[model samples]
Target: MTQRRRGDLLVIGGSEKKDSDEERAILRQAARKALEEDGGRIVVLTVASMEPEPLAEIYQKAFGRLGVRQMEVLDIRNREQAYEPANVEKLAGASVLFFTGGDQLRITSQMGGSPLLERIFALHEEGAAIVGTSAGAAAMSETMLIGGPTNRSCLSTLAMAPGLGLLKGVIVDSHFTERGRFARLMGAVAQNPHNLGIGIDEDTAVLVSENDEELTVLGSGAVYVIDGRGIRFTSLSERHPERILTVHDARVHVLGRGDRYNLKERRPIVPSLERV
Candidate 1:
């Protein structure tokens, strides 16, 4: 029997409102997860950002407003910094680990094989909520979509690399509709049909459950799930990367707030509405 995967994940699609006046429903959930344990703590990791302080400050105030008193910001610049004893110790008591958006490559390259990542995995197994926004969200998958054409789908235009692999068998692309990344995400799914492609829009998020079986949509925008498991054909093997991608029988499901999807079944479960 397969052991159940531990930890919940809040995968945000860039540009979630951080102000006190605005509706920060997504961040609110993160706060709730962080405060689950008695000595509840939150750790904001800014390792992905070039200028980590600003992002760190933003989350510090945001989480603070949400009543997270025990919070710390971890700014790990290089691999050397990621291996530091103090940096690893910072994650000791964290109930929630939030990763800020920037370059997905930075997050993997810096802490890929370090003690920091090992500790994070251990914490995840202990049921810590791992939250990430934009690039940070993209890095949660095993295969990360590094760069590719947003407007068109082409084999040559698509670039993929190894990611943190926090979430397996799924590839995440943030700022989905706002950035018009539909084609690119489809391109990724075309290349790897077994993996599910999730395109998240701005201000939106897909909260992955601790068991990793269900994903619930949260926030204002929609979450697009591209299921290429039923795909019959693809132009991926062709020599021309410039040519338009030809994929057959790719099913797409657009999930709004409160919608749930079963990852194992590869199906969406839309909530029924009541007559007013």
Candidate 2:
């Protein structure tokens, strides 16, 4: 088993509202935490998006509105740019590193095994807060859901790929409910029963702890955690690619805003209400 590292993660499910409404304050909360941790300094990585500058500017304005004055956008286009010492050095002394939404595969393929990625990992291990929205969120885990069948099926082929590995022992799927991706996530869990499948709905997030033991849900939508540890059997590998999959004994837990979960324990923790 791989040892989990220490770091805070703000994994947004994607399509998070970035306005001033308190009802839609998920991104604001993340920005506030990042500002508090690193004295308002933030590094935004746009490696996932094809149009890096535009995406970076969007976040720049978003975080800027949240009072993050010192924000630098690292527009690393390719693997060659990832190897640049100056580009890699952009992560140094940053209190927070934020990844924008786009193609998760682009992130892993371009930055994987690069010195820049190592620096990002080092900073994360050193207590810097890492934030990802949408594809960025999906790429945080060790096992990532790339592409899969939209319809429910026992024989559906769900593609899996290596991610940033910021969080381990789990797989994350974004735009879960809105996109009707429950079957896809279920297929992923059926294929790899040892790992947990987390399906996060749009406008929500799972705030993961540094120890990787706990996570708290934020935003209006829900977070679904599928645990396959109790799974008795699965015919995902044996069945033909066109056949429906068969899975048994997979436990699932649904969490809403303000709900907390114990990741290591594979259970939900009831929140305590204290009166002031």
Candidate 3:
């Protein structure tokens, strides 16, 4: 057998809340599908510094119901247990690790560049998987957006902050379509037109790995991809640095399952592996 290739990363948006029983069923299937492709086990580490009770409970149930042999949430908020040896061991063996949504800055500030973060990166390097949603997902990029209700609500300009930079060249913004995060991501795109902007919608995820290879999509919502290379931006040239900035000329691709999304070519990257 080919030594199972891993280090695959998934970032997601929120799930749709509906009266229909089919809603969560679809989301759960999407979650399971994404997780099963790499490894069927998971260890969810809730280090985003968010409101933990409900999100943790919901995830625990979801992953467990997916029939994963082991599913857990490692609470690193407690200073006493933050560096505990037992915690480290649990994380080391996890096939998929999740970071809950909360504050992106807090997540990166607390965990980034640390031994635990190092271990997670190493696990990803060794072919284990990693996934995060909302704030959790946003913090994984090179240039993360730390503060924002968004440009719509704020009068001046959308705030952009430094990110953990785990997935370089790929800047992510969660809660895409539902909350209208495209403009904010576009602002970031303006900063680095060469980088790819991935705006993950509610109940959706974008899967990326090393290699200018395959990038896949999972879940109920759409993924907005903004490719700025070879495009002209008349607005970025303006000195006001305020309202009415436009990156009018870049190509944007929206992908769902069975569609290809490439990381290198910066468009609808194709899938290298057959769908399981």
Candidate 4:
């Protein structure tokens, strides 16, 4: 399945370091619409695990004042240059790749199944344009949240792990609603109730298309999306390790900043402002 689109991704939750003008005009209009649909390339800034002096010279000088005048900083956190497959084929010739925040277990313990994460999933299935923020959107979810104890009255270290699924059936949980994280994704979907729980917030972003789980949101915060299929969940069921849960019709969408949502018709759309 060669499913990927060459543009549109600006998952930010850390952009607003006062370079205002509405965050440099939404990072120069999503880097000029991903370089007008992938022709004017180069915007790779994985920063591996980050902190190479103010996050690679301050986000490569603020994405080179927003035109993204070429950038490449594959630090991959030195667990041996993140298991080189020629540095993931030079970050799969990035048309736009950014993952920087920190410690989603150091990116699934140094890029899981590394060949630079299978050439960043073969450069996002040969189309390019993948973005992440806040531990790179909590490790692009197939279950991930390696930091524990939110102390919102839940812990077993609130443990739920595994990630770098690059957005499959979802579970992303960034600095959601400014770190309350709604009981750590409501106890991580009550111990994984058929997955599909995101919590972005903190400048916000949700933007899905390939495989089109029909998400769409942007900056200035909010995106909860819980959707635990029906109300009859049993929290890891009998032989339970202390998780008795029940949620009837559990759905919560609280979007903002150009809202649109339809993760398989869970519905909400109607945005076309046209303000450039």
Candidate 5:
């Protein structure tokens, strides 16, 4: 059987520095990958935001400053727009599909089961890079964290829904430390112990390699990996909605820039100081 080829995915936490002249490493990496094919054509999807144009414009200038000459913005506002032929055509031949920060639910609701999303899946399988930030990043996982209390995790406190499922085996939470969402993420993993929970800090990102088995940390902040496979117990069914979540033996790994992780092995890979 022939296997499908998939592109790299950059799942970024919210609030990446856009106006800085120092170095836009994340955006630069995105632009460079897009330019490697299809004449550097990039399609920015602002479907997650209520005000899509403003967000789209921000990326336009950011990518433009990075020497990306060809770019298009698809501000898909509703389910109807997602099925439009014009919108579907915009994705054709694009080398990158970028999702901006906003409500992750908006992304799944509008684009789910639509032709536009199907086309995007096709593009990804054909080597087009899939990039998402903030809520966009959260929606990339199989399960999404919709809403919950920030500082604490309790049974029935978190609201979760099915995500876009472009990436799987994990649940993602963005702006993790800045917004105090650690507890909520822990609750999620406690409920679903088989799936890993990833909490990403602002300006940070986890780049899933093309093989889909590894992740490389990018940007200045940290990435928290919550492993529940070793979890011995969770008090989800035994506790009330507001009761604090209790999970025993859950392993946590904090990774910094240049750190690499093996998703399949569920372990962190130490970086070598020597240059390759």
Candidate 6:
């Protein structure tokens, strides 16, 4: 059997700095690095946003300032355009494919099984870098967090939908700390204990390297990992549908800038500096 080739993924939290914000430079720096490593051409997908044009322009200018020579915005509004051969061809020769923040459902619903999405997966298999922000980030996992209440209660708080499936065994939530979404993520994990839950704070990101299955935290904020694999008990299924849910012994880890985690191992990899 042939082994499947995997591409790098940069899952950014919401509110990434576009203009001159030095404090949040890590997010853009990681993007620039991805571009430099692969072909310079970038294809920006704005299908998720309601106003694709403005979001496209914002990224165009921002990336232009970062010295990205070749870039184009593919604002695929409907299903007809999503499967267009001409539009799919635009993704050819592109080294980076970026999805901007908007409604995650727009991306999954419009382009879900389209030829354009197939082409993107092909390109990613061939080593193209894939980057997403906010809703885009949430849509990278196989199980997407569509909507949920950001409250302490876990009962019926999360609504899930299918995602792009770029990253498996994980569900990503953005604007984590800013929106106080820890409870929301816990609710998601409670429903689907098989997958890991990753909550990323605003202006933060996690760079997942396909080669080693390791994730490196970047930017100013933190990344929270919720592992429900060790859960000894749960009231999710037994509790009343309208009642609050509960779980015991769900392992949690907090990673700041420069911290790294091994996805396959499900543990933090100590930094070299710490050992020295």
The prediction achieving the highest lDDT against the true structure is 1
- Clashing pairs for model 1 are none
Span of 10 residues, lowest total lDDT, candidate 3: 148-157
Comparing 3 with 6 on TM-score, the higher-scoring candidate is 6
lDDT of 6: 0.85
TM-score of each: 0.95, 0.93, 0.82, 0.33, 0.95, 0.93
Off by over 4 Å in 2: 1-5, 151-154, 273-276
For model 2, which pairs clash? 153-245, 154-244, 154-245, 155-243, 155-244, 155-245
Q: Write the per-residue lDDT of candidate 2 for residues 1-276, one digit (tens) a residue.
A: 966455689999999987656655776766765668645578998989998887888788888887787888998788999999999887888878888899999999999999999999898887778999888999998989988866444365777899998888899999999988888898888877888999999999999984888999999899999999999987765548777788888899999988989988888987686611
**Candidate 4, lDDT over the whole model:** 0.66
lDDT by residue (tens digit), candidate 3, 1-276: 767555767777755332344555433543553466555566777777566777778777765665555666787775445556777777756767777788887777776656677788788777776777788789888888765555363222456677777678878888888887777777777777877888888877777765426677776778888887756754654456555666668778888855667676555645467653
lDDT of model 3 at position 1: 75
Per-candidate Cα lDDT values, in order, are 0.89, 0.85, 0.70, 0.66, 0.88, 0.85
Model 1 lDDT per residue over 169-253, tens place: 9999999999889988999998889999999999899999948889999999999999999999988755786688889999999
Residue-wise lDDT of candidate 6 within 20-139, one digit each (tens)? 757747446545644576457888899999988888888888887777778888998999998889999998877788999999999999999999999998988877778999988999
TM value for model 4: 0.33
Put down candidate 4 lDDT per residue, 102-177, tens digits, no spaces: 6677777777876777777777666666777777777788888666545354442366678887776778787776
- Model 5, residue 166: distance off in Å is 1.3
Clashing pairs in 5: none
RMSD of each: 2.5, 3.4, 4.2, 15.6, 2.2, 2.7
The TM-score-based order of candidates, best leading, equals 5, 1, 2, 6, 3, 4
What's model 2's lDDT at 173? 93
Candidate 3 Cα errors over 4 Å, as ranges: 1-4, 16-40, 78-84, 148-157, 209-212, 237-239, 269-276
